[model samples]
Target: MTQAPGDVVLIGGGHTHIQVMTAFGRRPEPGLRLVLISDQTHAPYSGMLPGHLAGLYRRDEMLIDLAALAEATGTTLILARATGLDLARRQVLCDGRAPVDYHLASIDVGIIPDLSGIAGADRDGLAVKPIGSFLARCDAILGAAVDEGRLRDVAVVGNGAAGVELAFALAARLRARAQASPPARITLIGSGPVVATLNAGVRRHIHRALDRHGIARRDGVRIVAVEAGAVVTATNERIAADTVLISTRARPPRWLGETGLELSQDGSVATAPTLLAMGREDVFAVGDCATILEHSREKAGVFAVRQGPVLARNIRRRWRGEELERHRPQTAYLVILMTGDGRAIAGRGAWLAAEGRLVWWLKDWIDRRFMARFQTAI
Candidate 1:
């Protein structure tokens, strides 16, 4: 193999980077080399994760194989965790291997759940990010419950879409596993109204779905701590549970603070509309690890998926020393809430809401199509 004149390093195999690598694979730049650094071999498609947990989809069905993608694209793949960056020298610091140098770089590392606000949560509760660890933890919980002949109680902390869908998905999974033993008792613990970020009509549908699943809902009460076998509330109320799942607010990785890149108040890399790092022309960032300075949005998978093409185009422009394009995200998009039982809730804007099996089928169709691209592409 020969070394190209310039090196373009992608720090993580995130949603946005997938598109960037695929584009460069199709249209090679003779003077540049492409490289990818990732901790996991398979990047899970988030949209199908809930279904996978509910036993509706297989583990492989939701995964994007980084090794295969790299091979197909003729990109070098490094299996290592990124620690920080040396901005002046243009190097990426890794955990075990030597530093990787780059003429141009991009970071797309995702966030983690911030459990500092709730005492003991960081120690006692399981986080649902990093995808791989969460799946293993779910398996451990289910296996232990089976060995004990029954699952006593399971509590999910946070009332957002992930938490809500997780509560229902776990309920369905556990109920099926409880064969001859007593039924599983699942509870949803929230600091505010269920799915508070969604519209009221969508919230109504989720409420109905919760009752139909026999999962108890405890809302409007702040959970202050995760005890040895229970969760304590701000008002000193305690709820017993055999297992605790944390799906709270997203927090940017702490290592980003050491990179010397200008970051937003939330600790994510501060980038312009073109996704270039502020005050730097050689660096860029996208997905959950970046905060678009001009038009900020919540840390959602949809925004990351949408950023894929824009980040791809801008990188090509920068490589050619041409003007970059701006990415203006839409104000609103359709929201799908999976019920874990062949039904889904679809909402857009502030007033419209619909729920039915057809909606679930629509969601399934869309997710499958997005995944099919990885198979047919680099």
Candidate 2:
């Protein structure tokens, strides 16, 4: 293999980097080498993750094969965890490998649930991000319940979309498989109204869904600690549970803060609208790891997907000494919430809310199409 004149290193095989790599694969840039450093070779598509838990899709169906993508795109994939960034030296430090150097670099390392502050959560609770680990543990827990022929009490912390969806999905999956014991008891604990970020109509719909499933809901309650067989609230009320799942708000990797790059208050890499790291031209950050300074938005996958083309374009423009383009995110975008059953709710801002099996089918179709792109030669 020939060493190209310039090296473009992408850390983390996140959603944004997927599009970047796919685009470069279709149109290779001569004299430039592409390298991807990722801890996991397979990237899970988040949209289908809940459905996968609900038994609607298989594990492989929801994952992007990074190794295959790398081979197709002519990118060298390094299977190592990124420890830190050497901005002054233009290198990526890894745990067990030599430092990777890059003339141009971009980071799309996604976030994880911040459970460090929660007492005993690290030891007793299962986090839902880094999807693979959660999936594996989910299987084992559910498998144990099935094999033991006993009902299990499952608790989910956080009332956000991920937490609510996961709670319902877990209930649906457990109910589908009949055990000799009684049905599993699922409880949703939240610091505020569950799905509060969504529109009122959507929230009402989710509440109704929870009621129909006979799932317990605890709102406006703060969990002070997680115990072996239960979670203790601030008021010392103990909520009994056999398994605890965490789907709290996103938090950037701690290493990102250690890089000394200008970071947002939440510890995300602060970047200009062009997706370049703030005050730096050679480095860029995207996805959950980045905070678009000009038009800050919540860490969402939709925004990251939208940033992909602009990021790739800006990277090329910088390389060619051309003007960079700014990426302006939409003020409001379509929001789709899937019920564990064959139903989904679709809303665009607060103006519209529709729900039915057709909506779920539409979501399923959209998810499958997005996944098929990576599964094939593209």
Candidate 3:
């Protein structure tokens, strides 16, 4: 069945785009049709990612079923990767189909792990950027560990939230496995201080969590190369590991750079306060792929989730010839870090850390509730 031309084409199933889908589902604009284009049928929510890595949540639990979402939202779901964009033509180019024509387009394709310059990164280490690929590789690694009855060593490169969460999750999982046998030695290497963007209290809390898990932390260590069983640092230090997870320097999808859209120095799509492309009014962008001026926050799922309503409103307004509303992100939001067990740390700014199973429970409840909102109603 052919869709009578859509008003807006959303590129990618990232958090922000998903929110747009949900909002439009609840209250759709009759004239402004929405189409969602994504490579994955199921897009995982980033908040529950650490839990998935630690084997706490099943794949289904962590992922949002985009097919069902599209069905409920009355939006077209095209399961294909966006290869390019014709800004002047106001169309989206896909890998294996006719170029999709649209009056407006929003890109939330997310970021790709930057590993081109790191020697052997593309060849040896498994990049943890595309969540779907990372999940598959993680399964393989876990399966091998379970079969061999031991995992030698695992290295997680990067000091940001993703890296820290993944490192702790791996450590927790390995420790749990070791309780039954021998544990795998895990090391987290970072080029700068861990959680450098976070407040001091949050940083201290994470450091304590890492120590508690017995996961070794190496700071100010640049990864020069990734080898078969070792990661060489810029200082000529070699750290041995059986598995290497790349988790730093996220770059915008290459296609964005090639599309000739106004881009930030880092290659992110430049957008206005309404999240529309800088030069093209018909084009909008969100998530890690966008560089929104005025309120540039670190690439976190929270920000992406918050942008959904604004994006939805703006998209509809664009079709109706109405002014768009600007999105204002919270100056400070609560950060809850999971320990891969049934515990977590909650803190903001410089303050003592508070720990309890309740925090974990709160996190679980919050994540589950957020995910349930998007679950296909049977």
Clashing pairs in 2: none
What TM-score would every model get versus the actual structure?
Answer: 0.96, 0.97, 0.95
How well does model 1 score by local distance difference test? 0.88
Q: Output the TM-score of candidate 3.
A: 0.95
lDDT of 2 by residue, 254-292 (tens): 999888899998999999999999999899999999998
Model 1 Cα shift for residue 196 (angstroms): 1.3
Residues 1-378 of candidate 1 have per-residue lDDT tens digits of 233478889999999998888888898877887899999998998888889988889999999999999988878999999999999899999999999999889999999888888999877888898788888887887778667765677889988999998987887687667672677688998989998878999999999999999999999978989988899999999999768898888877899999999999999999999999999898999999899989998888899999998988887788888899998877788889788889999988899899999999999999998898786655
Off by over 4 Å in 3: 1-6, 179-181, 350-352
Ranking by TM-score: 2, 1, 3
TM-score of 1: 0.96
Best-fitting candidate, scored by lDDT: 1
Model 2 segments more than 4 A misplaced: 1-4
lDDT by residue (95-152, candidate 3, tens digit) is: 9998998888889999888997689998889888788988888888776866686567
The positional error of residue 373 in candidate 3, measured at the CA in angstroms, is 0.8
